[model samples]
Target chain A: MAILNLKKIGVSGVNSALHKIVENSEKDFEIRNPQGQHSIACGINAPLNVEIKGHVGFYCGGMNKYAKILIHGHAGVGVGENMMSGYIHVKGDTSESAGATAHGGFLVIEGNASSRCGISMKGVDIVVGGSVGHMSGFMAQSGNLVICGDAKDALGDSIYEANIFVRGEVSELGADCIEKEVRPEHSAKISKLLKSSGINANPTDFRRYGSARQLYNFDVDNFESY
Target chain B: MSEDIPKTHPRKSATFDDYTLSEIRRAAATGIYDIRGGGAKRSVPGLDDLLFLGASLSRYPLEGYREYCGTDIVLGSRFATNPLKLKIPITIAGMSFGSLSAQAKEALGRGASIAGTSTTTGDGGMTKEEREQSEILIYQYLPSRYGMNPDDLRKADAIEIVVGQGAKPGGGGMLLGQKISDRVAEMRNLPKGIDQRSACRHPDWTGPDDLEIKIHELREISDWKKPIFIKIGGARPYYDTALSVKAGADVIVIDGMQGGTAATQEVFIENVGQPTLACIRPAVKALQELGMHRKVQLIVSGGIRNGADVAKAIALGADAVSIGTAALVALGDNNPELEDEYKKLGTTAGAFDDWHEGLDPAGISTQDPDLSKRLDPVTAGRKLSNYLKVMTMELQTIARACGKSHVLNLEPEDLVALTVEAAAIAQVPLCGTDWIPGKKNEILLS
Candidate 1:
């Protein structure tokens, strides 16, 4: 484990430093900075734990796998994009498109997330404790998006294999996003995620959303007008 | 607005058909044809009664409405390793407003949203009205490539790269000058009424190898949060479907002949492509051979009209089905109230003249102000919803009779073809036994 203090490092220094650490270091590391900057900890393969104390910019921990990323402050747009597998935790608010298109992994955001969070997610689990912006989880295939607070408009449009759970008011669901009962598997998963996210566990409060499995592809009979 | 302007003069009182033909002529040059989207110019076998051969001893019908007719389909299973999980199997096909009235396009969005399915955008950029009305909006990134913005991309539920359409296979989309409004022109970044020419190939890449990279780039641009669909006209669909999978498409949309368009060359509409029935089996064969069927999720469109057509398409191995012409009919296109207008055009209600010109009496196809105004979006959408219900009912009945819980389970094993073309394309035995080509599927996959 290596400790990298950010009292003296700004965006440029931190970006350069993290790039170097990513190149040279291969284990768990602590990055001490509290400011938000773009492209923090992008594309790292080796298993590592990256701890960021402050806010970050677009694409923080993007396309990363085999690593555990913990952000103490808020995050910018497109946080944890296309992640293959790993764990990411954000303590504060996140900008648009949080945990977008992640195939496999766990992305836990303790605060509100902006629009399009978990868009096209394949097999990832995105847990947002607060409200999310519009068009969240659009066209997602396989994955789980859990919003502790409310979900904005167009919740799940033309979705495939993904499942969504929102606890608070749903501004409006997209083309799809029907309410489904929380089953035992879902209860167990939510219970564990609540524990990992450091929140009080109450799995029953959340409403599950998944494909009515109606519009998986295209069918003529379903399209009456056609 | 004058309830009866000189627009309908006895001497100049033209039928909706006449206006469209003249408009098309004005939009055309010496030999060049005007273009757009919509349905058939010539009559062919449409989605009326390609009746199903229901089961007997091993099958029993379920109660129609009470029966659980599951239409669930999974997309992007094989190629992307990740696909869009849609709730229903019915989806709206792509239709652009640059070639149509704004009201017409909005109605499409509203209708699709009401039905709990997805609506697709045309070649132009994402419209705010569409975004607002559409529950699941699939944005198209076309060869012409208008309105390709990252903000909309991120917001989109999925991205469809439209290669070509069924009515005009290997041909690009066209918006005649008469239909081009100021707002439509601005949004498309092209001059109004200048005969818009779309890109023949994608601006992003040259070949299939490059297409793979472009797909990745699109994922990166959206932060990997949108399902990417590759749509192609039913020309060499077996190869196209196989290659699109290789290029990493989550879903494959294969459009066949009889698919509608706003405007296309009359020649292209009549010629240039295989029938919808012929095209579907080849595409399905490709996916099944590669073990990508049901995994990659194949959507087949063209000439789809009724519940029987829908059931037949599913039985042929399509994960889903799309419609254009049937949608128009449901929206009140062939209404008998427009009978007088049709007489003036030398046609009738069910036989309305043409779709290319911007002068539809029902206000479904044209861009003309008065013509389009005739269609009230609210009323039109309600009709569309009703129409959609009928289709669902038809399919449910078929699904029940077939002894299947879901319409999607109505497989080829339950069907037999009446024609050699139908049997060959459908891959079922020639009306009696099971004698499909094993090498045919392998060839398509290869």
Candidate 2:
């Protein structure tokens, strides 16, 4: 394992190391003293294990593909944004737009997530252990979003097909978002996601939410609604 | 058919002609306004109304063959570690991959590369072909954030944060279902065959203070190597330019009302924003007042068709000019060879503006496999390079005639407006007069 101290080497050194490591490396990297640095381990296409210690800033492990990233501390906004096929484990809390627009990835946030979490998410499975703020999963197209704790207002607003599993009370639902009955298959799926996220929760306790699909097609009658 | 018979024929008003009537009827029938591509169709004051005062006995002209005229410009030298050195003052504006075919995007890259200028990736995202073909690729960070990634950001030579587009300043963009191919769908993270509406505002940042933070974030992401550009519509150039400068922009791209789009409401496109001719002086004034003129580069775009337009924009105090509609034309969009196909769609070749329909015969705007195949990137790229070369030659000729060693040295003093509207908008003197509109002149006491 190679350890890169961000405080000692700085961001440029870290980026250069990451870029070079992406070219040739199958080894693990431990980044220390992240100190709220943005875009750490960004655009890493290689299959490697990256562990960042301490709080990191926006876009941590952004656009990550074929790499496993573990943030041992709280992450800022856009953690694992636009990520394609990767596993991001955030050990602590996160700010806005967590896992935003990610296509294919497994993002596990242990703590609470702020507003707009998983906004415009496409095919990324986001499992948050704690609660999520308002407007979570807004315009979400696909994938699964599982929240262990309570969900705040406007959950899954303007959503499209993406499944949402919330264990606790939801404040409100936004336009086109509806709560559906939790089926047996949902229990099995939520069971798997919860287990992977390392949460001690029962899958049967969750409710599934999704798009009502009314806004899919534009009609003359729906013009006033728009 | 009588030789001297006075015939009564039903005549239509030229002011409200067939097209206008059709538009009114269509609006009345549909209830929803028309959505189309390209810029404003109505005639507005443009660079065509300006003429350069070429050197005569009053000034010495440079010999065309012997003398050298510089056109090189360094962008993002204000704060960026690695600034961009463009060989020409012309750049290819941001046109998304979804709006244009992959081949068309590649062709733009090839042409820009051949011309030693830069090509930009618009809303949808950056493509591999675009990244590989173009030497200097500017990545656009739009409100939608479709296909935006950190890797592409680092890969780009510069970054353009799009606050607003010239065509529709406060409005969002629409990509119809027909044009959204599987590849485009994958890039944008939206389902295929669904009408995609991009956000008018960014998801992360809202106002200028947030914009400042966003710029800081981008700089931190790129390690301050890439130049950060802020592109704004020409609605409020003075305030917009000033705000962008405060937001730590290395370059400011001001796009005017005449700028093109993939798809937007016709009303928004035609009604919103200031004309390109009227925007330059105010933007220059803002830059001068900030005492950052020439330090932070300004790129003007919107209906920049020829070298004369480029010369005029620079004279009006722009560092560079970006072209989109004209670039598409040079790439053989709306060709007369496809006039039959265009007529079948109820429009003529030169007048066709329904680019959102995805039925372009020239293949520059469509996503259909058959249509896209018609545009060979190499052939189209060569044509674009040829057009760029001609434009550069024209600019050189104008610069030589103006007795300027460099195109950047072309000032407002070298220009005279042909019309009062043009003179007022351009803030230049009218021809055969020493008067500039909106300027305080002192009557000399002899």
Candidate 3:
């Protein structure tokens, strides 16, 4: 393990340091004095474990691939955006569009997430420990979004094949999204996801939601829903 | 008695034309707005409305074949460590694999590589064949992010952040169920045989301020190697161009309403964006105002057809021009030979635009395996390369006649408009008169 201080090398030098670490086949790294700098530790292709000491700004760990990034403090907008095949664990709350449009990854947020969380999420499995704000999972395509706490308005609006499991109450369901019965397989899946995300909650307590399939094909009768 | 009285001539109303009546009937029958492909069919002020004034007494013309007129250009030289170097100023525009067949995409790549130019990937992510065939491939990061991945981003020579397109400026993308094959479905992470509607706005970023950050993230991701281009429709070229430059773009691509699409509402295509002729000047003006005209290159598209259109676009201060519809035409799309098959589809050879239905006889815009097999990549690529060569030669010929050594040296002063609308829109003087419709008033006020 090696430690790189942002205060010494500056934010611009982070990429070169990451490249050097990857070239050397280094497995672990610790970044100190992050100070909410944007795009920190982003676009990492190699598989490595990285720990950020302080808060990070927008697009932290964006477009990540085959890496594990752990942020100790709060994250700004678009954290873990468009990530593919990686793991991002945010210990504190995150701003808007968490795990947005990610193709394949696992994002675990220990605290609450703001509006538009998992917006247009493709195949990323996201588990948020606390509540999520309005319009969360808007136009979500595929994946599993697990919310242990309450959800704000318009949850999973215009959703696609993605499954949403919420342990707490949902204020309202968006158009075309409906609650579903959680079967034994769904409980097992939820339980496995919770175990992976380090969340200790009863899988049966969560209720599943998904697309109603009514708005799959555009029809004259579904004009009102659109 | 009837002959002597003179038969009353049957009159037809100009307001309700034949085409208009047919369209009305179509709307009443289908209940859904007509969704099709290709560009605007309506006539507008285009490159044809402007003509170049060849050198006479005051200027010396370059010898046609003796003196060399350069057409080579470097795009995204502002920031990218490696910019695209092209033999000609004409490049192929973005057309997705799902919208076009895999064979078509391969043909585009092979043709572009032969012409020493670049081909782009569209809303659909980069295909394996497209990447392998194209020497210089520009990857489009669209709102859908369908097949977007970090590995593909690194593989691309350039990155184009799509804000809007000319065919449907503020609208999203639609691929009907007929086109979504197993391959397309797997790539987009959607079920097969479902109507996929791409988002109009990007999921993460919203405004220009956020766009700047987004650009920075991409730059960081790619290690600042690839040129970043911001593509916008011709709705508000001036503001969009300026804002793209401000957002740290290495290049800007402006597409006009005449630009082609795979599938979109006909009403949105014909009614929405500005003409290619009307879009160039404002975008150029914006770049000039920012003092980044040549520094941040501009690639204009929409209705560019031949070398004349390419030369005209360059004369209007564009660095390069892209072609979509014309390229398809060169690849045997809308061929007169396919007229009978087209008639079976209820359209003519040159009039077939229902690309969304996936019943294309020409095999250029379809996903059906049997239809897609009609196109041979090698033969079609050869034809496209030949067409690209002809267009380049034509541009060079025009540049020589205008007494310019390079295609980039062809200026607006060398062009005159044949129509008042063209003079006003292109800001060029009308032929035989020093009067430019709008500039004359500005000159008088000054």
lDDT of each: 0.73, 0.88, 0.92
All-Cα superposition RMSD per candidate: 19.6, 3.5, 2.0
Displacement of residue B249 (Cα, Å) in model 2 is 2.3
Candidate 2 lDDT tens digits, B219-242: 766768899999999889999999
lDDT accuracy of residue A11 in candidate 2: 72
Better of 1 and 2 by DockQ: 2
The DockQ scores of all candidates, in the order shown, are: 0.02, 0.34, 0.79
For residues A1-60, what per-residue lDDT tens digits would candidate 2 score against the true structure?
Answer: 889999999876776676665355646889999999877877677788889988998788
- TM-score on alpha carbons, each prediction: 0.61, 0.91, 0.98
lDDT of 1 by residue, B290-351 (tens): 88887787888987777678788888888888877777787788789889987876668886
Give per-residue CA lDDT, model 3, range A1-226, as digits (tens): 8888988887667866775553657779899999998999999888889999999999999998888999999999999999998899999999999999998889999999999999999999999999999989988999999999999999999899999999999999998899999999889989999999998899989999999988777787676887
Better of 2 and 3 by DockQ: 3
Worst ten in a row by lDDT for model 2 chain B: B437-446
Error of 3 at B163 (Å): 0.4
lDDT of 3 at B299: 97
Model no. 3, DockQ: 0.79
Model 1 chain B worst lDDT window (10 residues): B437-446
Residue B343's C-alpha lDDT in candidate 3?
92
